[model samples]
Target: MSHIKDVTGGTPIVLESLWKTYANFVAVSGIDLSVGAGRFCTVLGPSGSGKTTTLMMIAGFVAPTRGRILVSGRDIAALPPQKRNLGVVFQNYALFPHLTVFDNVAFPLIMRRVPQAEIAQRVERMLETVELAGLGGRYPRELSGGQQQRVALARALVFEPRVLLMDEPLGALDKKLRSSLQIELKALQRRLDVTVIYVTHDQEEALTMADQIVVMQGGRIEQNGTPEDLYDRPATAFVAGFMGDTNLVRGVVMAADKDGTLRIDHPTGRRIIARASGFQAGDHVAASLRPECLSIESPDGPEEPENAWDGRIAAVTYLGDAIRYHVAVGENRPTLAETLVVKAARRGTEHRRFSEGDAVRVRWSRSDARVLPPTRADARILPPMQAGGH
Candidate 1:
């Protein structure tokens, strides 16, 4: 395995203003993205968000309407799918029903006209790598779902392609199996140092499996960064709302403080003091607060800094490790859609439990509530990454 790492590994991939359109409909907008060698990058979005289209273009399966695809430093935009030297694992695993696992894994080498003996040797080793060592003779239906997935993986990696593109590869498995495979797949990638461009709509899978997560929407990239960066410091409201559970309250800026803060007038007729910048007194804004960031207590229980909203608990959900409470704004609107959700850790006897109709106050630190910036035009797209990329 160590020798293989020195001899075989990934190549950098660059997409320069990649665009794919059909008449009036644009499947993929002009987008610039750079994926370095051996990094796992996941393109995440809901279906029809163009993630699959972008990946298909990269794999040479679909012709791009415009722009270039570069592997390493060379432009390979015009190459055919088989000539691209990239391995693709489709959502269904796409195993041949009639072929045995051994023959399936050896298909690539056989196509390339490798000697019969070497093909056997490589297929055997790959089967072992994916923990399907003794089941090479089994057919796809004879194996469980997870086993079939491993067979698919073994088949793809047997020939050792430079980059692996997986379009929702684990989407068919159950939750437990999918979680376990995420760890195994990441470990296998680390050992081989293979660059992967994975596409999925599952945000948890994207967060867990990717070194870089690219969030796409409406045929455009909303943001791309490391998982921590995307989670903690998202650049857009779309990213914040899409990444996980959050409370979004619409409001208008009432005042701007000197130290990068804003006073917002909420629809509930209360003011929200948020740590933010770049807004005038009259600008409309929305504040994003995560469910876990808010604390709930009796109105007179404790006084905290920042801002507080007096509300009644509208709903209560008991998770195993934490309790979640949905609190309404006030008596006037007891069941508004903009209700605040608060999650409290249940630490045995030290936690305080509340009922659904109990009076409660929700408060968050000034830094925790972010006044989202105004949505910009497509001006945020990166410049062409290659002049002929260096």
Candidate 2:
């Protein structure tokens, strides 16, 4: 779309029982995934999670130990990377330093033995489409990081491949530029209607850009669904912890009330009620409460919330649009992470701002909390892996 020319738009992809193993350990287990035509899908996980390995397999950079990759319903297990006819954009913007931008983008066409006249026309049009109309003569070393990335993108898509595979292509840029390019890339993909399978360890990036997210851990798929589904109804404690900021309170189911209300007893004896199903009395479960769902019960007040706790602010973090309060409940021990984190938006409102050290009442509705299967009491959030690629 825009100035970009569309070629036979897209194709579907399927991975059946995909597995990859080295001498000692397995990288990708028997995982199955399907991506619809023209859709954008992201594989998300922590370090050593196998997202990158999976992408490499699909791109034919790495071979699957035993499995089949189907592109548009045909088995491509025997195809080489070039024979697969897919576009790939890497994190390093792998452009040749010796060649000019135009020649770099024309490399794929030259390899295919396309005529020189057609290559010139296609390279010019692709450059114009990517907003690099007048910089064709410049070398990769002379351009900015963003420009080099655009060149890489142009080169990948110049031959009009069947599908696109991006491996954290924006990870090298700074935050502000990366954010801007995320929007730009998604818009471009939509206009071109190309099926995209992206690999990244950044959860926020996945949430922002993907139509579907496949969460993986230890070489297995934990959950795969729309972003809203994964956020609102995570099926596992790891999914809840990895998707966003959540306070996972481990407890035991005490009883099942009318409707879906579940009565639970916290480890420290704090009672909890949640709307859930498929859980009977005496089931050990963890309750997930999002930071945004909690608030300070203002005195000028609505009716008392369904769940309330008295705690003093233990710490405060100043986020631009919101404030995070770490409140230590009086009944629970500090060493146990019984501290609840509350997020309050800076609305410049008439009510009031809750400050640190304030003895405040924290509250949330029963519907705001979700009951999950039991998990370890001290599972930390997935830390960003900086040194190695996932």
Candidate 3:
């Protein structure tokens, strides 16, 4: 049997071309990844997209149909879950119902036959670390959801395992509670320098907590990078759309200049200049621009010398922090523009200004746009922007 500590000093874990199939159906397909010691890695995807399956395989709950799993440099494909010495925190905060918070945090040490006095000292220190030093005697039923989660976390860390795996551990809490815990958890992980593999379907959670993100779809890795890398420079169309709100425009490449500039001819025959590289003439392409990248203007004046398009305002929405304007440019296509609410309010009264059917111009910087290859069959259009009611 392979040992977990063999790979813990530098390389914490490695999955070599991992594959998991259930009968004839594949759950995880050909995944290769490495988690270095003290790094925070997140596996992000929607449900049944193989993120959970991948986590289970690493934890030894689901045996792989192919490939080997190594903890450090030694192969542990056949090791049992208990033998691997890993800590896991689940979505439900699986603390023993009858045990007090202190006992729950101390259970792992007790199971390994540690002395009672040492367990007490360790448990007390862990409680302080989680800011629950005085709540150790309260049972799971008595503590709030957040408090119980902290106890669960303390339990996982008290064992001093080589790796920590969490499967949507904050999925059950309210938004406010979840956000607070996200910050706490991230700080704790960095302080302890633990190798963490977190699984979640929530994009915000992954972006908030992970040092590196691995996006999965259909049992395969779609993309992997730092949060900024994925957000600012998505390598694929799916990555761009999935990461956040983006405006995608389809056009034919009119020119591929030497300075990574692309001149595209939209379907309406309007030309737009954008930033891109590595494309041939006559190639079909798509450009992704964030809503905040576009600025709006009245159409009556002489046209502003900008990358501007004329469109009719389809709708206006006031989202406390910002105003979202949906501009109808052509048949069945609308571009969204957003501005700070403070700026919109300074312009004029809400009801009298910028109503639907008003002609307007949408302008954006060429540098704010990214040109990419046209999306494949699986690419999905962004959700329509919700207008704030007047």
Candidate 4:
């Protein structure tokens, strides 16, 4: 197992116009990606977005209709699953029910016909690495979900494969356990320096674990970058809304101010000033503002903000550490229908001051808002409100 550590660092993976097509459906489109050696990269997307399919193609479990999968600059698209030397951990654990934990982790070595003595030694080391040294005799059914997941991970990692592929391996665990495992799994990857191509729809998991994130949608890449790059300055409306809680306000560019800010006219006659790129008067756009950017002020406040608006407190949702105020603005719109969400964190002994039906000012800094092109995802008059704290 000491020698295994030296061999397990990683290998660079490249997908050259990779695609998977079945009759009329294209599961994965032409995707070109370069995953660096020893990097933890997560393929993130919703169901049917081709993220899992791309992962399968990389593992050689699914044959690509076109293009090549390369490892260490060598094409492996035609290689069989066993010859690819890529380890996989599925969501189901995929352990042999009849085998003990030691045997499960040793299965790959056995298949490769490594000496029995070597297999036993390596299995013990891997079990200890995964913090399961004393549970080698336990069967799959006898272990708890988290333990079983660790067993599955141990099995995949024990082979010292060049690349590790995991497909929602912690999906079945409870929330708290899943979070715990996410940390442990990331720590393990760092210690081993393994190249990991993980697939998940969980944005938080992707953000927490991956050094790089590739966001997929409709069989094509929507965006790829470090977590902060994607979250702070998303290039599209979908990315803006999907990555976090944001207000999407549709408007037409009325004019560009001398300071490089654009004046946008909303349908409800509200004018918004925000920073944007590549647009002119008469162009329609959507402005994205994070809830935390907005602040609630009393109606009688001396000086209203530049972007302040008069609104009535519609509803208040209590979060453990913060409160979400749904403030209704614009005439003729229902209280909850066209509301602005303002989130305020609570300091010790601080209490909410406004109640429903109270007049208030919902305002945010002009710099806090970002303007993006109108997207199909925001076809609704007002984009759907996602659950907060993404």
Give the best candidate by TM-score.
Answer: 1
**Candidate 1 on 1-390: residue-level lDDT in tens?**
011122244688888878887766777888789888889999987678888889999988888877878887678976888898888888774799999999999999999999999999999998987778999898989999778887888887777887999988887788987887789889888887888999988988889889999999878898999998888877777888889988878789988988988889887688789887778899977788889999887888665555898888888998888999999885586545459888888887655478978888898889998788644454323333355532
User: Each prediction's Cα RMSD?
Assistant: 4.6, 6.7, 8.6, 7.5
Clashes of each: 0, 0, 2, 0
Whole-model lDDT for model 3 versus the true structure? 0.77
Taking all chains together, each candidate's TM-score versus the true structure is 0.89, 0.86, 0.83, 0.88
**Which pairs, if any, clash in model 3?**
7-72, 317-388
**Distance from true location, Cα of 328 in model 2, Å:** 1.0
Worst 10 residues of 4 by lDDT: 376-385
Q: Give the total clashing residue pairs for model 1.
A: 0
lDDT of 3 by residue, 317-380 (tens): 8766567777787745443322111123324444435778887788888997787776444322
> How do the residues 1-390 of candidate 2 rate in per-residue lDDT, one tens digit apiece?
012223355788888878787764778877888888888999888788888889999999998877778888778888999899899997764799999999999999999999999999999998987779999999999999888988998999888776999988877677887787788778878888789999887889999999999998888888899999899989888899999999988888999976888989877777887889999899988899999999875344554545887777888888878888888874647744588988888787433366667778788898899899864333223323256322
- What is the descending lDDT order? 2, 1, 4, 3
- Candidate 4: C-alpha lDDT: 0.82
- Cα lDDT, model 1, residue 6: 23
Among all windows of ten consecutive residues in candidate 3, which has the lowest summed lDDT?
337-346
Q: What's the residue-level lDDT of 276 in candidate 2?
A: 94
